[model samples]
Target: MALTVHSRFHPIHTDLAVVTLTGDVDISTAARLRDDLAALLGDGARHLVLDLGDVSFMDSSGLSVLAGVFPLLRESGALALAAVNPRIREVLRTTGLTRLFPIYTSVDTAITVLRAGDDAPS
Candidate 1:
């Protein structure tokens, strides 16, 4: 499983979109991720769960793509990361981005957490 990027649709109890990062996400693939995120947003998919368990490597470029996407999703309050790799997690932690996004151990947990948020009185 080299680092690659692919997306899948996950129709859970609520609207769920799963984007899985497979291969290395460096400068080479950063744009692809960005495009994917933008496409999802354009398609009216506010709820996005990025599954990063298959990613073997990532760099600033990859991080930038995520940073860009987070705000877009936040505008609608629907986005999360699921099963993020430890290496990527470490990078995010070191950069203090862990607090910027909601991360969960799995997509199921993410959905549960998001659903809870939806149920909470604003």
Candidate 2:
């Protein structure tokens, strides 16, 4: 399945960029994902909320892209994941990446946390 990425500034919290992704994130799509993420950061998004509820699968390449952008977000902003599917969650847990991201149950919750500056890495 082809990956689709939708990016926009949070409606209420302009400082936060919300990216909603669907389909599989693997070798074929990791680069695009990385580019999109980098673009958001470069566009001056200080906080990000990734909504992964529609994403069905993710592989190592996808994880790598996420990890690569993590430090950038940490240094200049905040990053959070919302509505992650089970498959992706398992991958993150197995790879011990769960500690690097703040995972929330919903996009609204993530937006709130990020807007309040509560999702910063500890």
Candidate 3:
């Protein structure tokens, strides 16, 4: 099955956009993923989190989408991955992107971290 992505915006202390993915993320849906994510970034969403707990499969194409967004997110100091399964994490690790971004075990963790960062004194 092809990947289906559902995106929603949550009003956290800091601006955040969460996109949840389900089904297989291969060549067929990688472009959609890229477009949707890039749209979010374009809309001024700085803090982004992708919840991939429901994604059954992913490929290099999916990894490419993630990688392509990282630098753009970094340019504004935002973006992270949340609720990624071990299988996908392995792929991210193999791509040497594991340390490039913060990986959280759950969406709650991602929100908490974001909230904390927002609350921290600068």
Candidate 4:
């Protein structure tokens, strides 16, 4: 199935964006994902929290997109993953990405961490 992305900026933290993706993140959709996320980053979204609760599958292209954006976000803020499924988490773990981004139990928890201001990771 085609990927569906739902992105929204937090009401209180305007620069923090919560993006949720559903469906596979493969060659077909990876470019779109990258462009959409790059747009958010360019639009002043320094902090990004990805709600992976609904994401079913991902490939290297997807991982590349996630890894590629980390540097930009790191310059000012950081990225967080929320509600990651076991299979996807395993992929992240196998690739040692668990060290790169913090994973939270929910979108709210991730938002809370990001909203903590400078205390949040960059």
- Candidate 1 lDDT by residue in tens digits, 12-60: 5335577877778888888888898888777767688888877788899
Per-candidate TM equals 0.88, 0.92, 0.90, 0.94
Which pairs of residues collide in candidate 4?
none
Question: Order the candidates by TM-score, highest first — what do you get?
Answer: 4, 2, 3, 1
Pairs in steric clash, model 1: 3-22, 3-23, 3-24, 4-22, 4-23
lDDT of 4 by residue, 15-79 (tens): 99999998889989999999999999888899999998988999999999999998888877989
* Tens digit per residue, CA lDDT, model 3, 1-122: 87888987786443588888999889999999999998887777778888988997888898888888888877655677888889988988888988877899998898778767877898
Question: Lowest-scoring 10 consecutive residues by lDDT in candidate 4?
Answer: 113-122
Clashing residue pairs for model 3: none
Q: State model 4's lDDT.
A: 0.91
Question: Could you give the C-alpha RMSD of every candidate to the true structure, in order shown?
Answer: 1.9, 2.4, 1.5, 1.9
Candidate order (lDDT): 4, 2, 3, 1
Error of 3 at 23 (Å): 1.0
lDDT for position 122 in model 1: 75
TM-score of 3: 0.90
- Pairs that clash in candidate 2: none
Considering every candidate listed, which one attains the maximal TM-score? 4
TM-score, model 1 to reference = 0.88
Q: Mark the 10 consecutive residues where model 2 has the least summed lDDT.
A: 113-122
